[model samples]
Target chain A: MIGDAFTLVLLDPMINFLVILNNIFFGSFGLALIAFTVIIRLITFPLTRRQLHQSRAMQTVQPRMAEINKKYSDPKRRQEEMMKLYREAGVNPLGCLGPMLLQFPILIALFYAIRQTLPESPEALEALSAHLYQWTYIQHAVPINEFFLGIDLKLAPNEASSYLSPAWLFVVLVGATTWLQTKTTVTTVTDERARAQQQMMAYMMPIMFAFFALSFPTGVSLYWTINSLIQIGFNIVTYGLPALKIEPLLKSPAPAMAPALAARSAQPQSVAQPAPEPRTPNGPGRSKRQNRRRRPE
Target chain B: MNNPRFFAVGLLLALFVVTSAACGKIRQPEGWASPAVSDSTAYFFADKDRFVAVDLDSAKAVADPKSTTGATLQPLLWQFPSNDQKDQDAYSFKAVYTQPVRDGDTFFMASYDGGLYRINAPDGRGERIATQADIKGKIVAGPAVAGEYLVFGTTEGHLYVVNKNNGQLPVGWGKTGKDLGKGIWAPPLVRNDTIIVATMAGEVRAFGLDGAEQWQKRFTASGAVADLALLGGDSIFVPTLDRKVYILDAATGAQKGKEFVAEDWVWSTPAFAGGVAYFGDFSGKVYALDITTMETKWKPYDAGHRVKATPVLIDGVLVLADRGPVVHFIDAANGTGLNAVPVVNAGTVRAGLTAAGGKAYIATTKGRLFVADPVKRSVVEVGVGGGK
Candidate 1:
């Protein structure tokens, strides 16, 4: 029953929309997939933006979280303090998961939609007719041209007969863009152990998705590559290009570190000391240090 | 894994695995090869990879083990590409779609993987005659045997004419095969010296056995033609995906009359007997049209589900199976339900129904076979190798 409802609610709509898009894109299923990715990304933009904002806020509170971890040895006390710190920073740890969760259904449905729209076999094509709406336009568009930019969209990279086939190019793009998307994402981990794990994930995720692209149809790989590219753009916009020393285009609404840094600086000290500034790894501060060293006396 | 970042990544990976599993095996072909019965043994695809020969007499005598009476089914007579041959790369057919075409003592079958084999009926011993390299694409259309030549079309739009004796291209035919430029999903109809080939692009062309074009102009339908039938000796019945069946001149690719519009897409080739053509549409409505006037013989019989299998006339009763997997028996003379309650199968029936010895044989997508007695209005699941 759940499967039927899923087909009726999500898969059917997605398949129909894809068929319509394929028609609009001049029967190029590849172009339709790219366009579908863009549209899905746009529809879920608000949730994605909120997730990015939460990630940014988490990054700003990392120092306080680290301090709390050090001061409170008891696990309970540390967890309590951590929750307090999160509340103060206006960060919801689970907020980052909202968009990810939303994407799962869409991804699954899109997989089925791609398979149905660009059927590889005659039986698959006949099976497709049952899902189609009675729309004459959609009906005529089918037995869809599976070729897109010289690649058979129904074929996976592993299914490619030769190493030189264009399908392998999608595999490469899926890996490269996934790595870039992960690398460009702002890190929120303060603990050394967690930070190491996060860093490892930044590498592992790309490899994992790249491996999956081998088994997935080239159309799906194309979607992943395009989605990852869009996400990289989103990451750049939200977290900025740290390597290029650019500030985030959209600043965090709360600026969670400012009050904490100011309060710490106001505390009286026996000896003169520099006020603690929130560490922005590979951010403007690192560029400032580099600029200072480059200056001539 | 203790870290929240790790947890998130782990969850994402878990979801990927679950979704992939839920989506089922990617590119797995579901074989719906119809049964080809010769004498007491029925030859059909038992699975995507297993082609078995079942004894019809044993199948009828075997009681349903699932029933309270407790009688087990018998083992199959034989199966092609035996356990030993399955491991050999050359013997793999992958997925058989074409019904095994019997020519005397040997049966010919083609697979979706583009391999063709000639299997002897007695022992089920088979040898690959054509490989994927020779066909260049998947074979969905069944091969038609014409004297010494066996003709079949591929999904890549190439029509192959190989010698039936050996899998070699005939000497007079094109070296690489004639490129139709569109995928052929329907089996080519062989009539006299000409071969009628219908493509997925909805174009119907006639060609001679020597690979020469026999038609001055090709008849093009609005939708893809899935199956074709010979109305008489001179006319062809073309069932198309556009919900219209057109009668074309068999000698020349010309329309004989206006197309008969159906309630839905017509995929099944019309079963002809007497002066009427019997068929069904995707909408579950069985149709009977007079070949002479191209008019309806009676009100369309409602089968209550999608009908993909071509109906077979058994003892003057029209036996049809629907996507419902429900077998309906209709009176051939006038379109009326012959069976009060239809016998439902365990899976969807896509293969064309086969009639022999006054009974109808059905092979479902789930690999289950059924033998229906038209006279008794009863259907029995034919278990194979002690299993249903």
Candidate 2:
């Protein structure tokens, strides 16, 4: 487990790089953090791509889902038929959340690692500063000069770094990058409601992350910002590559049964779906039970 | 696992190494060393690494004695914990061995690594008393307990008055936690209302009880002092690294008398007896100075090696253990060697005589606390001391 490809591909090399950067850059731990973000994004690229693919699949099946909802308008019937439709399409509704769950520990470990780059207490950090074996380009990384333009990367707000002396530049930069990343991911939308929801998240989540980043060390913010840019680049390459299959959005036809026709055309239609796996009515009431079974929602 | 634990362990370990090294030698590198006792426990440096206390009545730590101290002495009771934090990272700093001094129930001492500790007098149960005040210098002089205050000089030429009960501590500053001086290595002596302290810079200062300077004086041959003892009728007798002792008037800060011409430095605080003083030098020679004539007394020292322990004047008998096998007993009135008896084991002695009840309590570098009837030469209670 310790020497697996996932560990090597994800954690170890990055940690080594972080330690190296931390040593040479005595005056600042920010670079070490940025390096960590880049490493994490690189490692998680495949998963991010998979999630994006799943999202596109969900979008392609939307019309069929709408037809199923219309056929079983009753709540209980709709739920059942939805499950059947999902099974036929071979899509797990929550499969897209896998990447986020996998990245939790990485996020935590990175947070803790960079926090050590610049620590509080002049005494406690002395050893760590002296132990700087990487980042030799910087003259002195001990004080991690100006917190990359205002953040006192050593303090944790409750201690020394406070809102009074907030690192505004770093905070704003982090917020901007985060906003950009969120926008790129959730912008593949057709409906105004989904777009509005995406807009709210794009603004809210970035602001939240930025607020937390300001109170913490700049090393962490540096990680988040640089990581966001890397992810944004990756996302643009993956999602922005394909142009729109257009002419559909240009003419908004107000046909009353347009949704019905779209749904009818979207499905594999009649026989292609619903496999003929088995048909055995051997029990005394087997035929009656099969007939009474709830339809797929 | 957490920040504070790691920080504390680091601090404690530093204190330990310093206390062990300083306490190890049973004397400071530059001056004299002594240990003070209050409640059956003796507090002194095992070496520079840690401040240690052994139940003077116990024979436990003395068994299977080992000299792993990296210095001279190494035993658990003689073993020290570690040191705390420092300003400039002292990559090469080591604790200067120091003896402990007492005031009431508290024992005060400093680790060469930068920790002025106030441990319980009886059990050495790390009480939160303040003896440390953060000043950038080596503390070789043990702290002199004055009432509720402690007076000591640092490697830098500054004297400090620490709070009675850790009003400001850990960082080794005043109650408000501020740097006050160059820091002391020698413990201070309390006389009436004044505290007499000395530094390695050869500057001595008399500070009032309120931490204000009363007077400051400089000595020509400034180096390091081993011990400071107040002479009778208001005079301070100081032993120096320059192989001499200077007697100064307590009131006017005037040099009154000077005697003793040892080949090496005389650092231990000499024992005073019927108008005479008995001391030892680092080269292992004990000398006695006549208090009246300021001349050499009849016998310099009764032992064969250096006298590290400060002699205690008991019923005209100057009783002490030093660098040799036997505890020397001299006539305080005449400088005559009365008797020299063998102790528990062969380890060097770390502390002096603290006479309590009818027995003499002695702590050795072997970590054995002995409660012996000076006349019997037999062990009292084996493994019966405190400060675990």
| Per-residue alpha-carbon lDDT of candidate 1 for residues B309-332, written as tens digits (9 for 90 to 100) | 888997789999988878898998
Predicted candidate 2 versus true structure: per-residue lDDT over B1-388, tens digit per residue: 0112222332343344334323421222321234445444455444434455555444334542333432122133533332332223422234434556666665556655445666555444553343345555455555666666665555444556666675444223364322333334456777776777765434566667775666656443344454577877577787765556777778767777655566555556766756677776655566678766788766566477655567666666667676664577766666677777776453666455566655566666554455546455443323422223
lDDT of 2 by residue, A169-217 (tens): 6678788997777655533344344456556666766676666655555
The best candidate by TM-score is 1
Fraction of real interface contacts that model 2 preserves: 0.00
The parts of candidate 1 lying over 4 Å away from their true place are A59-82, A120-123, A160-165, A187-191, A245-297, B1-27, B38-41, B46-92, B121-125, B130-133, B171-175, B291-295, B340-346, B365-369, B381-388
The RMSD (Cα, Å) of candidate 1 is 6.8
* Model 2: residue B40 alpha-carbon error in angstroms: 5.6
lDDT of 1 at B170: 63
The two-chain DockQ for each candidate, comma-separated, is: 0.21, 0.01
Residue-level lDDT of model 1, residues A139-228, one tens digit each, is 666577788989999888888999999999988898899789878887766676677877777777777777777877788888888888
TM-score of each: 0.84, 0.43
Query: How high is the TM-score of chain A in model 2?
Result: 0.61
Instruction: Give me the iRMSD of candidate 1, please.
Output: 3.8
